[model samples]
Target: MPGPAARDAQASGSPLIDTHGRVHRDLRISLTDRCSLRCTYCMPEQGNEWLARTSILGLDEIERVARVAAASGITTFRLTGGEPLLRTDIVEVVRRLAAVSGPDGPVQIAMTTNGIRLREVLPQLIDAGLSRLNISLDTLRRDRFRDLTRRDRLDEVLDGIAAARDCGLRPLKINAVAMRGVNDDEIVDLVEFAIAHDAQMRFIEQMPLDAGHTWDRSRMVTRDEILAALSARFTLTPVPGRGGAPAEKWALEGGPHTVGVIASVTAPFCGDCDRLRLTADGQLRNCLFSTTEYDLLPILRAGEGDDAIDAMLRSCVHGKLPGHAINDPAFLQPARGMNAIGG
Candidate 1:
């Protein structure tokens, strides 16, 4: 049950509104907490226990939740995971989500993947109505890739990126986490790689989501530093029209495409946050760093109707914090890692 504050907000007729007046419009759904690669930044080398099969939401339940959310104004849906592609029924999930329509039209469906298993499945996914992609490729060197993800699959990932382009996954975006000692030196090289593939690039500052809780600020390459590195090599200017987007955009002076930076640590964009997360285990989280979660699975499993589920979700959103307290002195790291929290 929600607290008194949430109840009061619901009385105002918009349960999704936080006290700060932010409206939720984007929903990130984690299909599974299972991944093919064990990225050092995401999970431990040995890894944590995986969720039980019975705990995860069924495809039908997922579609029902998505439909309710779409009707309530969540226009964008991003499928995440420990590795969403690891789910055997991922194509079927995409197909169901693609059919959910709002007043405007079909909901926009996107995915964030590691790209290891993407080469063979890219065509099926694209044909199943996946609209966009954000591939996580931290390094181009095979050895470095193996070290980062504990997997020697850089060749496969590169192949996947190329396949994504050939299949018309237009405006593809490559996401790279900028860590000081690890892959920071290759920022420019990554930019070049994106250019060659006709894909956009976004360099992100590493956050405190590692399973081992070993994240160090000193190792995090800030946005300013990334821009400085890029600027030293090429002319750069800001691109306009970034509303509530996590990434700040900049166009390369000589190129037609642009690059971006998601500086969550240095530049918090909580004021413009319009997104929420649904864990693979069927918990609704208002913020990525939230300590409390609203369980929707029990209601789903009990065969509650759409109205009952909708009201519960609304109450959950009303309890959202104004911002993730990343900069606060009393900030607390979430108990779950990025993998469990839906990335």
Candidate 2:
């Protein structure tokens, strides 16, 4: 049964629509900011500050916000983190969220993990109604993987991926960040690996979300270069019907398997974006590159009702910019890096 907030939303309409006419439906909730690996592209090896345990949203608090969001017409929720599996109560988190239903029905619960601990917790997550998965895999080589992630757990990630596939996670997505002189040479190899594993391969353009703030446009691999490199190795027919999905996909060899490229930099898809982010500490972000945040934790902790929560969310969406102005000259990277921002 729909709660009051949800019933109100249905009675009227989703209050999540922005000035651009984009109805926000996807919510990326950061479970925690403490990660297991210090991926070079994501964060530094040391001196990284973790959010205070108390400041982080509690289980009930998270459920309250999610319930309000579900009522606001958030149909999909992706659990992300420094590494969500690190949370001791991750399964319980999933279970609680799985129970929240939106106007469309029970909200689709997905997760984006580093895959280091996926094998151990996947069964529990699946049982908790996790509907989809996206695992980060930059390179197939062990040495490169270690160098990229600064971790010697490449084997563990691979094992987890295998376990996920074996468990029948169809169209399993493997996300790889393409960097010049980093994993660019292995583009074809990664696709082949994904095909062998029966998983979809997605190459992402390294955005300006690194902790170091040293992202050089020249060093970052552009979408064209990635497509060109792949085109030389295999036949790629463009897959149509790309709506709001960040990835632009192509049918590989005209068959079931496909490859995707999230060209966030060169080819921005901000106009069709339907995502909102909730940081681990309970701040609401309208866009991934949004400079401003609407803090919801304080209100949640103050015993505010769902109406207040829903109003804050509606205001956040109402103030959303037409697009992330990365191409604009005055663009400034958000103070929080991707790790802290719930990417």
Q: Score every model by TM-score.
A: 0.95, 0.96
What's every prediction's RMSD, in angstroms? Answer: 2.7, 3.7
lDDT of each prediction vs. the true structure?
A: 0.88, 0.90
lDDT of 1 by residue, 1-343 (tens): 9898766656423335666888788999999998888899899777488888999998999999999888777788999998999899999999999999876678999999988789888888888989999899999999999999998888888988988877777779999999988999999999999998999999999999887888888999998999999999889988888998999999998558899999998998989899989999999998888899999999899988888767877867778777788878898889889999996
Off by over 4 Å in 2: 1-15
lDDT (tens digit, per residue) of candidate 2 on 1-343: 9688555543323657787888888999999998988899889999998888889998998999899889778898999998999999999999999999987889988899989889999999999989899999999999998998898999999999998888886769999999999899999999999998899999999999987887888888999999999999889999999888899999998968999999998999999999999999999999989999999988998988787888889878878999899999999998888999997
- The best candidate by TM-score is 2
Off by over 4 Å in 1: 1-15
In every candidate, how many clashes are there? 0, 0
